[model samples]
Target: MTNNQPAPDGVLRLINGYWATGVIGAASAHSLFTHLENGADTAAKLAARAEISERGTQTLLDGLVGVGLVQLHEGRYRNGPEASAYLVEGKPASLTSFAQLKLKHMGGLVALPDVVRAGGPVTDPTTEVADNPHWEEVVPAIAAQSVPAATLAAEVLGLAGAGPISILDVGGGSGIYSAVWLEANPQARATQLDWAPINAIARRLLVERGVADRFTSVDGDFHTTDFGTAQYDVALYSHIAHQEGPENNIAVLARLRQALRPGGALVICDYVVDDDRGGPAFPLIFAAEMLLKSKQGGTWRRCDYHDWLLKAGFEDVSFHSAPPATLVVAR
Candidate 1:
């Protein structure tokens, strides 16, 4: 909404945002979209398919309509374009797992006040980064979200139809980059570095993508692990910087710089805010997410990235726009 809209409605939407979250979560939990994609066009059919009452089903459908994810015509409901593409179960970009996983993470937001007062997570930040148990459940869901970001990065580098190359994916959660880049170039081989359990999930993902033979995993924390020197033609550190302080980020970037070959590229993807921090709503809100979860993480700016990349010995740096994330490529 524009800033000139009604003040009360804006405040209400901000405060009652959980209503939308709950509506989306509940709809996904019941497989409403998947059923709608089938023959369940009417409320009765949907309720029967979902094992819920027709009255409740209609209410849920109305909520979905209000949220712009569903459309109703002549008493028949249908999934919207986005719903059909990304919310249906088993699609390549389905976010069903990620949406449900968020239902669990929303509980953490309840303690935001305490977290803010403490200036970080009320729980130990140590448990939240490298070894978080929730990583297994959340990483797969996160993989779907990475599809466009990884694909865009690969396109930006013109990886498709290119010759043989090696990829080093640091904290490569769902192994989406490996799958995308390897598919783009059949001669390419990729290695992922992440926690053992998360790497297990990524391995399964790559296996499903039919590129398992060319994919490998390194099980360790990126903060302590040796990235090795002049090894990778391309390195990806997607969505990891927001969980780290500046020094930690620079240290990791330096390691990744050393890990790259002479002309190698390192891709850093995250929700990067503008230098002025004036607008771009999602990244601004993401800073709070970092605040609620990490000891020193927030959405960094382009200047910050440029400075860090230069300090890390990257001679060239550039930025690219990717929705829900941005790419900072350095060499």
Candidate 2:
């Protein structure tokens, strides 16, 4: 009789997923795509430009080819379409800073086994770490990535027709979200609240975008900041909930609700999971990243958010499915 047991192909692939991550991370760290764009197509030229050994460059390039990030033809390497668009330095959509952020997280991710055994994170997730300079790069990189989503969000919220309004963007690093809204609605102004260092970045970005005249920066911890009662026409909590536990999120939501006008809306954008807390791979995997990096952060289910929003005095809470994330809007 023939054996009927299924092969563990998926499981094996999952186990080796880090191999792809490492290859991409290494390639990005070395600015390989930039080098390729600058005419270092051959491994010898790439190695010389990157200041790495020819053998190592060849091996890494082969791995990149295997992963579809690069293509090899006639003994020369070239970036694939996706890599060329998102990995090349100076490209409009370049994710170089995001790649660097991922590499920085490798330390905590590698210690995940110990963290799980100890039932907690082994590293401090607070911004106080002297060596944790990644945030400076990560904030702007993340903001750049959020531009499309922010544009979509502004459209969804109908901000263009909403007339003159005041927006409160909590934890708005780089103030990209507010800047997008202000751009879409000429009558709108925004106040962005974040830590001092991040606020500095937000200021610079807003100024660079020519929207600083309508933008205000509040530098402080959101948890203790006085948001001012009935101050904003809309309150935005973008990509923030997952970094907080339920209790903290609940408190934050209540505070934000109080800050909104009587008929204003609260907009939350994050990686939300299904009620059963299974599948939807991105959020589930991101939950692990949180556990490895934060003290009490993890992805929460949609139902959990519904309950919290309701309890926080929000009504008509609805979920919109956006690729790689979900948007929760409540009035």
lDDT to native, each model = 0.88, 0.85
Best by lDDT: 1
lDDT of 1 by residue, 1-331 (tens): 4777665877887788887788788888889999999979998999999998889888889889988999989988999999998889988788988778777778788889988888888887565555677777877877888888888998988888668999999988889989989988999999999888889999998899899999999999889999999999999999999988999999999999999999999999999988998756789899889888778999998899999999999999999999768899998
**How many angstroms is residue 263 displaced in model 2 relative to the true structure, after the best TM-score fit?**
2.9
Candidate 1 stretches with Cα past 4 Å from truth are 1-7, 126-133
Q: Go through the candidates in order and give the clash count of each.
A: 0, 0
Could you tell me every candidate's TM-score relative to the true structure? 0.94, 0.86
Task: TM-score for candidate 2, please give it.
Answer: 0.86
- Any idea what lDDT model 1 has? 0.88
For model 1, what is the alpha-carbon lDDT of residue 161? Answer: 62
Which digits, one per residue and each the tens of the lDDT, describe model 2 over residues 178-263?
88899889899999988878888888888887888999988888989899999999999998899888999999999999999999
Clashing pairs in 1: none
